[model samples]
Target chain A: MPEKVEITPESAVRAVLRDILGLDAEQVAGFDADTELFGALPELDSMAVAGLLTELEDRLDIMIEDDEVDGELFETFGNLVAFAETKAEE
Target chain B: MMLRLEEHNIGAILPDLPGTNESMQPQHAMDLDKWASALLSFSEQAENPTHVASFRGGSLVDHKIELPHWRLSPVKGRSLLRTMMRTRIAADKESGLSTSMSDLMETAHRDVLNLAGNLLNPEMIKQLDSAQPFEFSDTRTVRLESEAKEADAIVNGGPFWLRAEPSDDMDLVTAISNDLIDWVNG
Candidate 1:
């Protein structure tokens, strides 16, 4: 099997935004090791919110319970990067 | 920053190139709004009602309604109507199911082909009367109103729509198709 390549949280977030919501980097403002998501992107809708959750679960090879998702966790783009970081770190 | 990529879906996907448009930032937004308003007012008679069959929001050819996150396309408009039914099935919220087509006749983006799908034969598409212009005088509006009253018969009332399966009618169908033709030509 191929070894796990080093993937940064920034790149991962960009990949998800482009592939899922049809959004690009400019549309997604800011990033961080710690930041809020649900507040950042104004265009972020419920469908996008769902798509992000699904992508994270699949890409990180982790399982996120439905209860774990909430509006607060997605207040900004940074918040999203942080959440994925937690998954990646774990 | 990769912003606008010239692509539609996984099928219409173009090469991944980050397009730079310094002038289009504000202009792009204005264009989007203009397109939306044009599509909305494309129908001269609002009382005639517009129905979208399928919605997969397209930038140039289609528009998105964010409330339900539906993208009404000119060709897949019927799928929009199909989606309504699918939603009902998904929620498992069925009871009396008494609906009229009129109630579901809200403003939605539509696929042109789906409008006259059943009526038009594939054999004579080009020969069919598609580009016929609509005259929207007050008298025309009155004609629409009369047609709607007759069409309203199939629909129970307002909530009456949720209860029944979807059926086809000539007047509503004509309005839907003609509006799309005007949009494409306009």
Candidate 2:
């Protein structure tokens, strides 16, 4: 059997931020697990949420449902990374 | 050979008739209101040479007054005017003209978000950025990948055209239009 490919949440988050949000390399590089998101960032508005999610789904090859969303998931970068890791594993 | 109410701006005259708030109201209501207002205006102009007074429908005197020669035949033959008035009222309710533009746009924004929500991880949604117009560049690429072999090709320079399958969903179009309108208004 082929070896299971590993996907780190850090790489996934970085790719999503750069590709979908058009963030520069420097901006993305500065983000850490403790970084706050959602309401804290002016760029992270309601409209951008859709495009960002779409990018994450495409890049991570994971399915997400509307009912499963909550504020806690996006409270900080660490929360998001954990959520992504969970989806990736499933 | 048939007269349509939609040929005129009924919303201009009868602003309270439900869907007349926005330009997207039902075509039939608009048509009926236009025809009724025009007929009333024509009657007033014929009666008085210089005054050209505005006539608002719903007075006992107004109902008894006869329409000019041109409009008489259609009304007498099939009760077209009565039918049109009823149709316009029904159309108004269906068009949701009473809803404010801001409310409609807000609903559209939510719909776009919901559609995205279904396909994306909730956590990623929190990291979303502000909307931006998609930028297109000169270079384009086509790639093919498979288990054993992978190949990719790129073309650069000069004018380029990209084609995509057109979306038939009107809601999506409305959402995008509302977003652009918000951007412009801001």
Candidate 3:
């Protein structure tokens, strides 16, 4: 098994949002993990969605199954990071 | 003291991009000239113009079908015209090399067909230009016109290009193509 992840969740969260979401500072800061992701940013279309998933795979080194995604995981910034955390835990 | 979100550069946001040919034996002098002309413009200068010129469709147009020419963006048109002029200049210099109108056409076509890599399909752009009228609006697709009955199927030859990356699926391509065709025909 891999070692536990000790980095600040907040910073990890920030990195994902910045690179994966392609969110600018304002867009990044505007939403916390809990804020709504869908319908909030008009730019977060299917292409953006796919791009973010790829980034998450690269940065976190976690595999997200296609079937694992639904309306919920993408609901808010918080939910996405929480899922990432779970992957780290696993 | 704060950095604005809108101010951030996308190049800074993503990883860097890396860069992209050969000779073909042709039957006639004109064929060879066309091939050389295309290679010069495509490989050397004004790659984008050569792409836009495909919209003009010389030989491919002769076989594929035709659409009433719409004004492409001024930028593309001007750049294409400029590329043509440069090809003429280069042709004048080289004794063995030459270019023809047909060569210009082929290069333009290949440049465009390449968009399939990371984007939506153009469908049968040349054939669908004659679509009677269509009306559509969708995020992923548009509808062009058609004379075919039922209006259920998306025949090729519409006058649009897929400008963005799309998911890899037949259903998605068909849907988007249909939507754009419907919209254009409208």
Candidate 4:
């Protein structure tokens, strides 16, 4: 059996991005607070963002209201992680 | 999955539910009960089905007939509908047409709305909003290791279906097939 590791919001965000974008593990691991996401990555289009947000909600057990989503929230990796952290806490 | 099961001297068959995948029926006219009844008839025509193995949305139909069932990563219909709705909203935004989930749902109620490429009618959408896989004594549920939901067993793998593009995960396939084989022989 795989050992149970506590899933942090940041880790969950990274994993969701990797899974939805079909990126390599190393590529996702390379992401940091400064990494640009929405405009930087071609795969992070509107449709992909929808999938990404839903996957994040599923993985983190958080509900992200539609009104809560904005371009600023997806501007950078750090921004997305912060949003997920806040939602997870609520 | 069928090939692996055959290697173990077990026969397997995957029947496409009516109103989808080359079926003559219109998808907009079908709902959960219709799919369930169609699956029942299809299985009845088969020589003999030892057990029913359903994945995701398929689990919603597997409960109509009495049989030992194995579900892998089964999800609530509302979850699937929500993702599709979000995709629809995104697509509309790309086309310069701003739409919200409530707008899409209101349209769905009055007319057949194509959500994420699926043509869903009012009844279909309404049924999906509350559909859940029925639990019974002979049912076995499996989930990916990353999920928080309870499961009879867990396997390590990503949600391949959620990927932007189609991909293969042989390890996941092997793991699920092994579990099904064990359950069949256990």
Question: How far off is residue B181 in model 1, in Å?
Answer: 36
Candidate that would win on DockQ: 4
> lDDT values of the candidates?
0.36, 0.37, 0.38, 0.86
Give lDDT tens digits, candidate 1, residues B32-136.
Answer: 234345445543333343332222223222232211111121112232333332333223323455332232232112212222122222221222213111221
| Residue ranges of candidate 2 with Cα displaced over 4 Å | A1-7, B1-186
**TM-scores for all candidates?**
0.30, 0.35, 0.33, 0.93
Predicted candidate 2 versus true structure: per-residue lDDT over B75-145, tens digit per residue:
11112122222233234435674433234234444342222112212221222222111112311112111
Q: Which regions of candidate 1 fall more than 4 Å away from where they truly are? A: A1-6, A29-40, B1-186
Best by TM-score: 4
DockQ of 2: 0.05
Backbone clashes for every candidate come to: 33, 3, 28, 0
Write the residue-wise lDDT of candidate 3 on A1-90 in tens digits.
111233444545555555444455566767775788778767665445554554455345465654576778878888887888887677
The weakest ten consecutive residues by lDDT in model 1 chain B span B1-10
Predicted structure 4, TM vs. truth: 0.93
Judge the docking of candidate 3 as incorrect, acceptable, medium or high.
incorrect
Model 1 chain B TM at 0.20
CAPRI-wise, candidate 2 is incorrect
**Predicted chain A of model 3: TM-score relative to the true chain A?**
0.77
In candidate 4, stretches whose alpha carbon ends up further than 4 angstroms from where it belongs are A1-6
Q: Return whichever of 3 and 4 wins on TM-score.
A: 4
Note the DockQ of each predicted structure: 0.01, 0.05, 0.01, 0.46
In candidate 4 the C-alpha lDDT for residue B70 amounts to: 93
**For residues A5-68, could you state the per-residue lDDT of candidate 2 as single tens digits?**
3446667776555544545557878888888888776666434454455445544767555445
